[model samples]
Target chain A: MILQVAKSFILESIRNTGVFLGNLLPAFIFIICSWICTISIKSSPETLDFMIKGQFFPISIMLLVFAFAFSSATIYLADLKANNTIHLLKRTNISPAKYFLGIGLGVFLMMNFVLLLLLAGYSFIISLSISALISIILICNFVLLAIYPLCFIVAGIVKNGKVAQSLLVPIMLVFMFSITMTSLFLTINEQQPQDYYIYLIWNPMLYLSDTLQFQLNLNDHTWLPLYQYSIILTILCMVLSIFAKQIYIRQD
Target chain B: MLILDKVQKSYQNHSVLNGISSTFQYGHCYLLLGDNGAGKSTLLKCIAGDEKVDHGSIRGNEHEDVSNLVALQYQFFESYSFLKVKEVIQLFTKLIANPSNIKDLYELLDIAQYEKTLIKNTSGGQRKALSLYLAFLMSKPIVLLDEPFADLDLKKKKQLFGFLQNQVHLQNKCLIIISHEIKGLESLFDFVYIMQDGQFIEHGTTEELVEKYKNPTFSGLEAVYFEVTGQLLGGRIK
Candidate 1:
């Protein structure tokens, strides 16, 4: 059943034009837009290095948030209510926790796939800098792992998919917009991006940016540790998942 | 076998099911007949674990897992996006851990051509057929259908009832169907339960009711319903 559920997700995601568009199309546009912007700027290789170092964090963070929340919002409730899928799942021995974990895994993989595609697009258009690319991937991975538990938490509490989409929209838009704005400002005002960094320092987006900075210099190493972020988010996600499981069991 | 012992369910200050206790044995069809808002849907949902009973215990055999205990079909609200019929069937089959050929299910429901058709594009009756087919596909030992015959054409209604009867008899599966359209199926059911004022006011086999009442004036179970509940069959039932 678990494998079936996973396979169903994969098939349905690929089959549904709307879901397909929502999942992959945005990242495609983002990569294209980024490539277009870089081309229009006509930057030197040195300038490209500076831009990658300064902007990689924000861009990767935006992509991660969009992909994670998009998959979460689209699949979870629709699969449950529109098709009576959730009710059917409740009848099985498959625990809600396990089922949600499986869904999280599927969404994560899909997000990573999108990230890989975006990375390929970046390498093709811009000069491929190993450090910037690696740092971006690491940060995006962290954000995906951290936010996954919250996805199920949201899914468990929301009445249905429509409600899930409504709740997810604003948060995603805010973070995406904020990350984009901060990253653009940081990259353009490159003489000193650290001063404005305070505005988004506590932001998860800043951690990625700092990682990019670390990668660019390899000497300036004053970023929050990746292990620390992972541990915190993973624990937080587990806690939220537990709360969701309790709500689900009690709902019956 | 499924048992609900001293089940008490309420919302806010209003009670829906109060101390309702009943044991549904295996290998029989039980018809739950009641007026609107008489807790028929609530009872089935509580049994399905969609709604938690305020107080009581629902017990089944350890051998009979909860998944196999019941398959419930709600009143088709006709709300769903353009999901293909095959996708819906495959999803339910996977969830139930029951392997069902989508083609076989579609043929059984007379929706073979609807394999690739989206549910939103289907008619009311066709959607009902799809919902019923999915419920039947759960392949559980206990099947609960709420208003299974509502909005269904006479010919289709006959087909559905006949299919359900065959399931009960041949499969040895206990079928608990809740519906007002019980005239044709009343005689086929092993037991008839009438709910009124949040209680089972009358219950017995159709033949038993016929013999005990000893009146041809009460032509069928509908007459028995009007007599017991004091609500005209064709009037505002609730």
Candidate 2:
């Protein structure tokens, strides 16, 4: 039954091709802008690598946070509004755990598919090796998996697709604000002698960025181990999955 | 058989179902008829386990889930907004493992050519037919259809009702229908239940209720409903 639901959801996502393209358009525009702005610049290979490598993680974070939010918000939250498909699923014998896991995994996989396109574009522009890019993507998926269950929580709180759409912009705004503040703090601590970035200990996005940099073998602006933040995210994801299942039942 | 004892449900402070006690037997067609705001739909939702009862219990055969016995076709199911008609049908057939003559059911419902069409693009009547056809294929012991006749043309309506009546008689399933469309459908019901302001005011064989309330100048469910609820019947249920 879980597979059936997941298949149906995937099929539905395919049928709504317009939405898929709309969500993807942002990545295309960002890539086009980057290429256009860099076309006239003359730089040595060292300078180019330094520029791209330094910008890679932060740019990826911005694009990913936006892409994941827009795509998953439209895919799951809109479909979930009014407990639309759920009424049909609840009649089946599938357990709640299997049902949610199937849906979560389905959305995770599809979002990665979209993210891969963006990754390929960036990888090509930065001239990064395929192996290095794949590693970054695999680790980025851990962060993506961690955020989607929380989106389900938001879906449960909203009443319909319209509300979900409206709430999505503001939710993305919150992420943007959080990312900006963390970046500012990181910059401050690096330029100053005293390190006050410890205040960002609770910022999930900061941890995600640091984890990405650590995986890339670059120094994370904060000096946490890669495993530490991933462990924290994994625990948070499991807890959120449990809560999402409970809220899904209530919505049903 | 299915049974509900003191089924009480409320939304916030407003009680939608106040102490509804009833028993539904197998191989019978039950009609739940009521005016607007009469709680007929709420009672059906509770019985089908789609809505939780704040203070009541619903019991089916021993150790059986309510969903095992009853399947619900809600008035406005929103899932159709995304799936294709064929995908929807495939899910039902695959999950329930029920053998179905897909070609015949599709032809009978006049949806054979549109199987590949997206459900979101289907007309209202087509969606209704598809849902009813899928529900028929599942073939649960008890099927609950809330306002099944709302969006069909006359020909499709006749085909659907005839199919429903035949399914009940052939399978000996306990089929429950709740609708305000009470005119001329009294003959299709073995038992009819009436709700007035969240309470069951009257319930019995349709023949008995109509006979008891029938007058020299008036008869049928429309008049019976008028006598019971003190509101003239609207023409929409026809």
lDDT of 1 by residue, A65-172 (tens): 565544454446444654455675666556766666666666766667767777787677655577677767776777666566566556666667777777776766
Give candidate 1's error at residue B80 in angstroms.
8.0
TM-score of chain B of each: 0.88, 0.89
Model 2: pairs clashing at backbone N, Cα or C within 3 Å: none
TM-score to true structure, per model? 0.82, 0.87
Leading candidate by TM-score: 2
Candidate 2's residue-wise lDDT over A188-241, tens digit each?
577521144366554456565554454444554445665676787688778877
- Find the candidate with the highest lDDT and give its number: 2
Candidate 2: residue B146 Cα off by (Å): 1.5
TM-score of chain A of each: 0.76, 0.80
* Candidate 2 chain B worst ten-residue window by lDDT: B229-238
For candidate 1, report its TM-score: 0.82
- Model 1 over residues B1-238: C-alpha lDDT tens digits? 8887898889887999978888888788888878787888889878887777789877787644444477777676343344577776666666656643445446556777677777767877678777777777767788888777877777767777777777788888888888777666665688888887678988988778656554345567777777777775535556
